[model samples]
Target: MDYRYKVVDLFSGAGGLSLGFLQTKKYDIKVAFENSPYMQETYKKNHTGVEVQGDVCAADYADIVRRYGKIDVVIGGPPCQGFSNANRQKNHAISQNNKLVKQYLRAILELQPKAFVMENVSMLKSEVHRFYMEKGDEEIVKRCNIPVKDTFLHLLDGAFLFDGAIDIVKDENLINQYLWPEADYFELNVIYKSAKNISKMINALDHHKKKLESLIETYTNLKGDDHIAEEARKAFSAIKAYYDGTLPADEIKSKIEPSVMIQRMLSKAQEIFQNNIIVDEYVQGSDLAAKIRSFAVYDYLKDILTAPENNYVIYSDVLCAADYGAPQKRMRFVVIGIKRDISEKIALPKGSYDADEYRTVKDAIGDLEDIKPVYTLAEDKQGIVLPKAENLSELASTLRDSPVLHNHIVTKTTDTALERFRALKPGQNFHCLDDSLKTNTYTDAKRTQNTIYQRLKYDEPSGTVVNVRKSMWIHPEHDRAISIREAARLQTFPDSFVFYGSKDKQYQQVGNAVPPIMAKAIAKKLAKILSKKRNADAKKNCTKGNGRQSHKRNSQHKHVAYPQH
Candidate 1:
């Protein structure tokens, strides 16, 4: 069976969301809309399967309808300039009519896909709520008869929307026309029992289990009597009984006896096991991680509420990228929406690695040859590296003249500075520089000159990459700033992904581009979901005796791994 759905990506920046969606292999990317030529080139190179359109605002909705017929899914992050925290500090006002964000919403309305994924900074949530409050209040005042103010009506409407139970306006005319009007509002009440309680119970159980294990370990280490193990088990049982509310707290405490000693042991056990607990596996940095997780939860609720209709079922599974042999600590939110009337949830395939075979940075980029630094003599007698070779250079170079050239160049480093550089590893920072080497450059300057620069350590994960031009990213070994390639590698872009633009633009794109591995993992999850949906659709068609021929495809496609050179 050909289990695939079509996807349209809007405001597609270097194809992060598009890449994630493609990972599932179940969705065919039909079109991608982006504005920047540099980003368009990068997106085109990575996503040859999709039609990359320029400037989404300039693209006609009729053209999209004409080409795709009907998009199954729409996924994109609208430009977040308004919602960015940095912008918030600059007294810049966010116009509600930002054509870019509005254009994205317009596409969603036009396409009317089965589902659409909108990602933006967490701040957008507040913006949305605020808009709803203002517009919804005005709408209620114009429409509702309740003497209560517009805010109350808006709240009532929201409550009804969430509860999926409309009160049916007593007015016959309104009920007949507006209330339950042609299923415009789908029933979406999904009861969500907090997972927190269950998770807490599990933590309590594990905590006691660990306590017993520690006692066992201590007894074994001391060659004490085996009876101590039994004692530990009994103590754990008492705690469990207390946790389950089967025994009174005072009774459990009395039964355990010597409360002080028990507390001491528990504290010791907690200390011993503190580092072992994996509190949260999800890596920070990706802007959409939390939203995706929240959406998964929301979808689950949506499914439960609409279960009676048996129209849609949302299938969810937790998948960690590390398990799939991804070299980084990448966790993803995966959701599969299936038509409940047609098929069951699809089972996720097992990941490719065991604990012992976890992928690492070495596996991702060890083979790439390191570029040696080349220095050229400056007119002032000091030396600096030519940013690019003469013949290949196509763009104006932006590398600034070195401030060190203003002073007499010191060929020989002081013993302390040499020791500091020697002590610096690939990712070491200025903090590692010895006090003697810590120069007094700031002494002659203002407060703004107090910023310190650090060296990048080659062997470790790079610090969070950004578009700033501070010299903080200098080489750990060499005094020069890190090359653009190194920054891209740090961001986990693949070696094959070539950026085309000015040096600064290249930096912005690299810093902004989603790590391909992260994108791949997200795509894989999305692909799994789309596959499930397509399978459901196929089953429905088969039952109706209107089946299409199967499209047997190759099992393997060329895959790109991360730590781009």
Candidate 2:
């Protein structure tokens, strides 16, 4: 069989991966998947003849296969905000956003591509969120009464469970009757609010005999509105007495089983103190591990993605873009799968350069130093063309792939802001400002990192160049923020690969892309491996065909003497 090595890019942002793979001149990128209108237009503009689609979930793979035959490889970077370290509040709902990863998996399963490469934020590989998750789960569970058997409850007229005790049993219809939400026994409330029904209370369920006896004694001395506590005491005592007496096994089993209250604090050797609990112990008490483990889809895919049988291998690791020669320091979790039946174990190329020899901000934008930029005229919101360059480094030359640059236009600023920029040195940030110049952007004026209004350091590698329109990343030498063209340069987008959108949208597209240069190196290496496999497969087919021909010739001449005859 012959091979063409076609590729499908999922979650394709701004065509960075496509550009890199094109640079390899190996596989043909037949289709790209990007939902953003601006990014879609930009990709279409740069890489013509490729089909672009929106919505990965709604993608019609059968149609794609007809247009472009069996896709050999699938590559892309899914949205990472759900697992990004920068997100302080991580939860089941937030992590649910990672369903995009599962969607990527769906493409692989449906297409059964020969190989796949995926990237996400690095924090996905870390367990740091466990501590916070466990804490949150424990608190939530406490507020929600966990049953001894984990069974949900049936309400008076509808479906409801764990409508536990009120945090405070309130005023009632009568003096003796305690008030609960909705009065009919199930509160018209949310999950968090449902826990107020007292049944979930830890004190209510813990050491029933002793807690009730103590409470009973206290209740004897209590005055007005002590009826709720009295009723709790009587219930606990009755349950304890019922357990004390022997009942038939079936009878006991049929009846409600006793469940102790859930405890937030834990115990160690001969010690019991909530105040003494440590971080490690606190985290262990949570179901956070279970929740997080549940959010992950790889384990579920293992059964579906059988190795040796499926002819491919799927695995992942947290990779640094810096390792791939990206000018900025970026860490992303990369998931790679190689179809062994099509090729050998796919080893991603080792980085050519290390930190000490990292590509710097200067290497990325050195040639544009002399060029001054003007603000947009609102009609041409896309920046002015950068002047022709001179004395470009090898890295710069690659980044400036085309002679014409599209986003060289600068944003306009006031005199005061320019004056503040004059005070900021290359490595120094807003902190370097004098007391008079230091505005109270922060209440304490000391609560943030130096990066808030920091300028790029010329010699050092740049920080992650995010959407600068919002963050307003200052230029190293210039008074204003770095221009869109400059930001793209830092991102290793070739000069010719112009972005098609409003200035803000263009900046976002540039910021979101994988460094094309780094992506190119990866593409180049993977292409080599695939190319090697294709050649080997072709050679095997040739030998097999020759063998068949030889056999046919031998069969025709049944014996050697027959030919002579």
Candidate 3:
């Protein structure tokens, strides 16, 4: 049975997503749209025989439609820098990168694909960082209602009342117990409930205060009737004191009008579906009138996806790479859209491993040939000898078996920085540095991320791997940052797939790649649905008793995996 379906990958960085679909032998990858000359070379070289389009932005849709008719799938993660939280610049909204998402959307609309897959830095779902979608962005902001203030803020506000008390009580540990950010406030049961109660109190108090303020605005404080002025003055003072915390909770109960609290929540709900961050997983967004404009996509799609209730759209929880036996804890967000004619719902395969069974950093990179971690700042490892591979774990074996290594090069680090790496324990980052070693002006040691300059724990899945050229990601057993091959291994790139370019470009290619193992699973699920539909059509044709044979399958559709150089 031929299950081949044609696909076009936009923003096809190094063809990682294409590689995933290729592995299933169920896809006929027709075109990959990438603009970078170096990345284009990598995709064309690794995904041999697939057509690599130079830049979709410049390509004419009419010509593309004429050249390749009936493109089954359009898939891409548009340039994420526009939506990325890491881009702290206020002008991120106007970055040319932000406009690239529309380019991706344009491809989908033009191709009219049966389905599409978009991979993005999970922040696309948030309102925190704002981006201009089009010319009339101001109108988008004007239409948004002031979101009832976040209750989680109220929880922290309420719980904060105890921070000083706990400090005085000499129980600093208690603060950690109650203030733990183990999950978003939306998911934390008590935190959300507490915030809900506080929200209602704030709303009621604000409403009354606004009313009294309006009356005072119309009638000068002296012009108001004496009793009326005295009553309004007392109400305002009582509400203000309640916020100041001097009036106490019981006193606020008397001072503020109590409204029905927790209207947003229902009784005995099994699941509290919340707009948690873009999971896969991570990130959130913010602001009042301006912030709500970012949810234009969410509000527009949400009603259509949910109101039909025909199971046409399925909202799956975030997919964690560790759960799928990947050697890293990389998380990602995914959404699937099926054309009405194909299937009603998509079934995600259950995760193959639990947290305890997650593949580890050791499981991924342990058997690689080792190189001495010491290197001068200008050292280029063109002839560095590598140690023999030993102690191969079963998982590591699947990633590589060849004795010859490629891209086994590390960045140059200073002797002083090496000493700092030595000081950090496994999984402890710059935050754990001693005062003498810490940057002089860096007062907030706690603000340091645990993964920065931290050694990977041997038995745990590594966190998201980024370009470590200037980063402080230390090798688990060594003082230096991980080599390119090691980073690729952690990203699950097979040994045969060698990246071509300068070391910087190679690292960028690896850092930007989607984990192949994770992508394959998604491809397999989509393949099953497409295959079933094709089979059903064939059977129906047979039942019609046509004397003619079914359309012959194309011989060229048979694909060969990429050949080694």
Please report, in order, the local distance difference test score of every candidate based on alpha carbons: 0.44, 0.60, 0.59
What is model 1's C-alpha RMSD? 25.0
For model 1, how does the per-residue alpha-carbon lDDT over 222-301 read when each residue is reduced to its tens digit?
Answer: 33233323343454455556556786444543433322222222222232123121111211231101110011112222
Clashes of each: 10, 9, 7
lDDT of 3 at 90: 22
Q: How do the predictions measure up, each by TM-score?
A: 0.47, 0.67, 0.64
RMSD of each: 25.0, 15.9, 17.2
Residues 453-530 of candidate 2 have per-residue lDDT tens digits of 678888888887788766657888778888888888888887787787877888898888887777787777777777
lDDT of 3 at 242: 56
lDDT ranking from best to worst? Answer: 2, 3, 1
lDDT score for residue 197 of model 1: 39
Pairs in clash, predicted candidate 3: 127-286, 128-285, 128-286, 280-331, 280-332, 281-331, 281-332
| Comparing 2 and 3 on lDDT, the stronger one | 2
For residues 1-565, what per-residue lDDT tens digits would candidate 3 score against the true structure? Answer: 6667889899999988898889899888888889888899989888998888887788566675677778887777776353333332121123357557668756765676777776766655555323433344334234443122211111111211211331221222432332212222122222222232555445444545544344333323333433323433444455456556677534554332111111111110101112111111111222101121233333333333333332234344467777777898777766566665688776555678888888998888887636553233224334344455667787877887555566777767777788888898778877778877765323254565666677777878888888866557788887777887888889888876777677788889988888888888888888888778878999988876453422222322333323432
Which runs in model 3 stand beyond 4 Å of their true positions? 81-95, 129-294, 298-317, 369-391, 401-403, 440-446, 545-565
